[model samples]
Target: MSKLSEKASEYLSREERLNVLSTSNKAGENNIAVFGSVMAVDDSTVMLMLGENTTCANLRENPRAALLVYVPGKGGLQAEGCRVYLRLRAMEDTGERFEQIKAGIRARVGDAADMLKHLAIFEVLKVRPIIDLGQEI
Candidate 1:
């Protein structure tokens, strides 16, 4: 497993950062969604809760995905963030992580948390600068 750099990990630690998750189905149909629940569990692990939606279904067919963490910059592409390549490690509807995420959502959004369906865990494959100038995170 590849570990994310301290910079990348730190970027993910911020709760208000924008997280955009991208996934593709078996047929190559792509899907992208913005989420606030995505989080880094460790240098090489990430977790998020998903409902019974296209993102979840796409992951079931194809485990590979990418998460873009974006922090706005003063101008142009001077953003402070990274794009994390990932592979699905597991998906569970019930477990410690699931319970934690569930409770967190419930606390943050009240009854809207009921929409959460499964907790998805992913292994970090790589981390790169958001601008992708061939530089590593």
Candidate 2:
């Protein structure tokens, strides 16, 4: 797995960053949801805590997902600056990784972690800037 860029890593570490997760269903219907329970695993993979919801159902049918991460400001989430969009393909399910990720989430999020029944592992396919307004953003 390759490591995430410095900028992306910084955004991932910030708790206030906004994340919008997108997926498509078996019938090619688009679905977007607010999913904040995500953690960067290594440099190329991410562990998204999911319940038995539409997002999970969509991913089960189609493992493709795109995560939009926005840098927070005094105003709020924006689309023009300091954003990293990631395209990912689902990885295979493994018992060891599932247990480890569950433990990790429990460690970080505590009791509420029980809601995370499944770990959706994704392989980073690509990362790109949303609007390159220059100035290292």
Candidate 3:
């Protein structure tokens, strides 16, 4: 496995623990929602599941997306200007990658296997990390 920077790894892990904001396309507009199970596959890639919703529909039409996540808890690291831009690729209904991701999800959220069995897996490509530090901490 490729290793990520300390800061990047910390940010990704923290984001995995919290709900992430996923932005997709709509009818000439933008649709954003909170997703509970966003995960990082590597320093430059993320994986998520999309169901039959406006977000999924929009992704089918326009695959570009942005994800935002922040740290949680008191005295947690403040993350405001951090974002990830992804060029959405293929959406998998079922495959080896899907099983791998599902296993990872099961590790995080127990008892979600059956419920998520029908969800579609999305593979994101060319993810670019954008972080802006407002002030020195």
* Top-lDDT candidate index: 1
Which scores better on lDDT, 2 or 3?
A: 2
Per-residue C-alpha lDDT of model 3 across residues 1-137, encoded as one tens digit per residue: 12334454466666444545555564567788776656666665566765567777777777777666555543334333245566665677688877777777788778755455433333433232344544321
Off by over 4 Å in 2: 1-3, 74-100, 103-111, 132-137
TM-score of each: 0.94, 0.73, 0.65
User: Quick one: how many clashes does candidate 2 have?
Assistant: 0
In candidate 3, which residue ranges exceed 4 Å CA deviation? 1-6, 74-81, 106-137
Residue 124 lDDT in model 1?
A: 98
The C-alpha local distance difference test score for the whole of candidate 2 amounts to 0.69
Error of 3 at 27 (Å): 3.4
C-alpha lDDT of residue 44 in model 2: 83
What order do candidates take by lDDT, descending?
1, 2, 3
Structure candidate 3, residue pairs in collision: none
TM-score, candidate 3, is 0.65
- In candidate 1, stretches whose alpha carbon ends up further than 4 angstroms from where it belongs are none
Question: Against the true structure, candidate 1 has what lDDT?
Answer: 0.90
Best by TM-score: 1
